[model samples]
Target: MNIPKNHLWLWLPFVVVVCAGYFIIPSNTFVQELVAFGIMSLSISILSVFFKDWRIYSLVKVLGYVFLAFFAFVKLSFYNQYGVPISSSALYVIFETNSGEASDYLSNYFNGTTYLLLILLLWPIFFLLKGLFRKNKFQEKPLKRAFLYKLFLLLAALGCVFAIHKKFKTENIPYATLTTWDDYLTAKKQLKDALAIPTSKAFTKIESKDIPQTYVVVIGESTSRWHMQLYGYGRETNPKLTEIKEELVVMDSVITPHVHTITALEKILTLSNQENKAPSPNGSIIQLANMAGFTTYWLSNQKPVGLYESIPTIIGSAATHKRFMATDDYNYDIYDGALLPVLAEILKDKSASKKVIFVHLIGTHLRYEKRYPKMFEKFQTPSKDLKFQHEKAIIQTNRYDNAMLYNDYVIRALIEQLRRQDGYSYLAYFSDHGDEVYDTMDFLGHNEYHGTRPMFEVPLLFWFSEKYINEKGSIPKDIGNRKYSLIDFPHTFASLSTITFKGFDASKNVLDSTFVQRKRIIKDSLDYDKR
Candidate 1:
């Protein structure tokens, strides 16, 4: 039944308002995810309207249908996990694809590329099918109501375009709200402060070269500290590490500075907060590591092209102003195994003196089903319907755990593999932040639990190979049973590599023999790490 004309106005405006509000509000914070979701929404609804034809059974047509269905499903899943940002679905591809497995991402690259290409190709076919094959059976003059609907939709489209332009416009982001001189000064000071302070200060790199100790700090993604058995969690999420209790030291109380990648990882790499972090032009960690005579490498499973990682990736790619240090970059999206080939190459030559490899794994990241190849998901529930909340969460969590199991295997392999190396070698694995994983407040993933300990808490492990312990010291016995954050990483590296670098907060070492001295440590404070 047709609605009354006046009623249509109310309902239509209501629809538009909801459409704008849901997509606009949250997109302000999580622009990428929200944009992806928005695209998925626009694409799916547009497809339904334009491609509901009889010939959708063709292979190309089936592909178009697949594009619509898959993007919608993934986009909906992300919205369910991280609340819709102005309702963006741009990260929909990210959701449907694998995440947080640092090493495995390299292997998944070609597949991801193929999938993206297929999506692009399918869209054109869909457009062609709509434009060429669509039959306009209504030959009569267009009804006023239909015209009005089109006009309203056009207006809505214009609104969406304007909002998007405003969001993406270079002048609007991160610095957009600074409308006054005071705002500019505040932002400038923040930038200067964040850059100037050292995340890890050292004595100075004047000492003569000793036995080179290469420390690889691997940061896992979305890995909840609570899920791992090593972190004193009840679950056997880390079977490989659990069996080898003697070699690894897991710091159960390790917390993150932030929950979102942009916030957490940036601080981790820089290790500076408002008080200490002077807004210098260089990235904090990269700058410090170079000064300490260590080459820094950031191999990430996270996509470098996106917003969450763009800043860090660029910093890692840039030439460091300090000593012979370059943030030699490796795109982690190309499957973790692909990086292995590179690692094998790096180790095969054994040319570098002291190396610091930042292997950022997409560890136990979610939607969970996509992280592990199908073979590893045998433990995942055999259910396609994702509407049931509990079942879906359990299934996805299980899948994520299985992926963790795989990472545990890889880590163990790296451990054992490094043991074969002829030099003093060390490997440490921690996470950027933790996931909620249906355990805390029954949330599905990270970013939702912003500023909470569970969101920041991660499994931190330090390993000094028997060779290192037998050679250098006893893996610093005091390093055990201490709470730490990414804030301490640069200092810890300086201590381990024996690099006497200046401008570091050496007094706050997690491994310090007298590290118990701390002031009132506030929870969820903006200075979780820097202070």
Candidate 2:
């Protein structure tokens, strides 16, 4: 068939749409959708030549453009913030969240990707609308083979829709919002059930032999030791920590049991050893602390999500008292300094003869720029060690280091506050997991799929008050070099608190004289040494 030469360029708009979706979404399913849409555009252009009903053709063209633009906007909005395709985890974290969290995330983290998406959308719309107005004569019908070939294209276009559904069973094509709500409800139900399931007793006997004292267990989030000068990084990211080095015992070879937040914390805050590393409903550090007659207090800078309580919050609920200092809502992360005032209040409370204080910090989770205040941006010069993979890589690295710097200040202040207080005081600190920030790789976050050594390597430190040091003697030198995982924290905590429990394993405690070095396993089955 002889078609108008000018009309042949109608495919340009489809090509633009495909290219735009590729860059903006940058996922396999998204590419599949673009391919399917491209085929539809091609078929429509070809069909316009054979069919004389202009109204029907024009309506189809308008609807296609509208769908394309709407789909692109959704993908672009989510991709800019998450840097990944829409998934169940993201859906639960977003929709199950409050307006404050959503607001914080949009205000702080939305970057250059927003503008790039806009350009991609506008370019395609320009050519597609222009092509719609051109007058066309009835082109001569082509060979039967040509019509069959065009018809095959239409089927293939529809097949792309099937291919997408096959890959992502829950995700809806053209309208991805359907999956967001569906996955959210499904996940919420699963989480609810998981929390409801009961477990058998983990401990048979429990006892505490120590005098009245306040023991502080501080848990940090997404902090990599590689970014801290205390761990020998080039930057002055740990000035406060360096100043108080004599009182602190830095465990140099410590790594977390998992690379993700909830997974690592689950193991860290439970009596789950290597044989039973999964978090048990029957046992947790708080329960053990509570059993030993120590009044437990859970104070945190990490904001609690609306109604959707996190695993940490559930675990923290075992404490006699609980407080969350952060007010940033869901996606918007806040500074850890908000916890300082609350920590002061907890320290002043003398009603409990023996107390266990658990301090959880927001601690450099993500959106690094917002994790610290302006005064903490000490690393002004671009880091020479960092290699860029993303456009904001350098800036992100700088912000991360600054966050670490601020974290150092917060921790040091806590230590000083504990020191000033009367009686025996023991403070131990470790992050839930480390993060990847252009360390060995060009990435700047932690994920289960792309696990790295830096992602599990975290900072572990213990501080003793002058009075406690004088009474109990200095912390053992062996504790500094001990290679251990946070999974053994329950055993170590029991030992430090002078608690004798049935599940307590002396060999697992790094401070214990009988401490044994076991295989450091991460992500449940993989050995850290092998990984």
- Each prediction's TM-score versus the true structure: 0.60, 0.71
lDDT of 2 by residue, 323-420 (tens): 87776653564888888888888888878889889999888877677788888777766787776645467788888898899999999988888888
User: What lDDT tens digits, residue by residue, belong to model 1 across residues 336-442?
Assistant: 43445555445555566766666766566653555565555545553332334576566766776676766676677666666677577788887877776556455
Model 1 residue 432 CA deviation in Å:
0.5
Q: lDDT (0-100) at residue 459 of candidate 2?
A: 92
TM-score for model 1?
A: 0.60
User: 54, model 1: CA deviation in Å?
Assistant: 35
Q: How well does candidate 2 score on lDDT at residue 72?
A: 51
- Cα-based lDDT for every prediction: 0.52, 0.71
